[model samples]
Target: MRLNLRTIWKMIRELSGDDAYERYLKNFHKLHAHDEQHECDTPLSKAEFFKQWQDEKWQGIKRCC
Candidate 1:
């Protein structure tokens, strides 16, 4: 397979969880930008996005089996 620098960088960010907020914002705009009710609403700030991400990640059941 052929992978360029941009693809490599994107893979690194994805593996490191560094682009979660950016992806969220992109999806938000793509899906909500034209919706009247949501047009005025804003995507979460970076801090808020990370906080929520962490909460959802760790606040679930923990099992070893």
Candidate 2:
């Protein structure tokens, strides 16, 4: 058997919503990175982002069939 890392990463990103976080980070930096006094490169680290993501996810309807 061969391990398909690309496919595995895609599935993990979809399930964990990491791809969204990455997109958010990209947009955040693009809009805010110009500030010379910016205190941080990222508004939220992976841990904080994941916690908030989970909270928002379960706080309301996630999906419906």
Candidate 3:
């Protein structure tokens, strides 16, 4: 990994989907229409959601090897 600015930006963009919340909201609304899913008026705020989302991705034992 180069320490250049472009490299850093690319890494950030990849790890953090540019519009994750928007996508989440779309799915939220779609799923909300279903009677089986729980009722909710909102999704987690950006900071908290992103923190948990990223942490969850790396927390478990990965089987990629």
| Estimated TM-score for each candidate | 0.70, 0.51, 0.52
Task: Please estimate how well model 1 matches the true structure, expressed as its whole-model Cα lDDT.
Answer: 0.84
Best by TM-score: 1
List per-candidate RMSD values in Å: 2.9, 4.2, 7.1
lDDT of 1 by residue, 1-65 (tens): 35688899999998778998999899988988678775366789999999998788787685677
Q: Distance from true position, residue 24, model 1, in Å?
A: 0.7
C-alpha lDDT of residue 29 in model 2: 81
**Candidate 3: tens digits of C-alpha lDDT, residues 1-65:** 45698788866875678666667778877888775567676777888877877788788786776
Residue by residue across 1-28, what tens digits does model 2's lDDT show?
1468888988899787768778778878
Q: Give the candidate order by descending TM-score.
A: 1, 3, 2
Off by over 4 Å in 2: 1-12, 34-42
Model 3, CA-based lDDT: 0.74
Off by over 4 Å in 3: 1-16, 36-38, 61-65
Q: Candidate 3, clashing residue pairs?
A: none
* TM-score of candidate 1 to 2 decimals: 0.70
Model 1 segments more than 4 A misplaced: 1-3, 37-40, 59-65
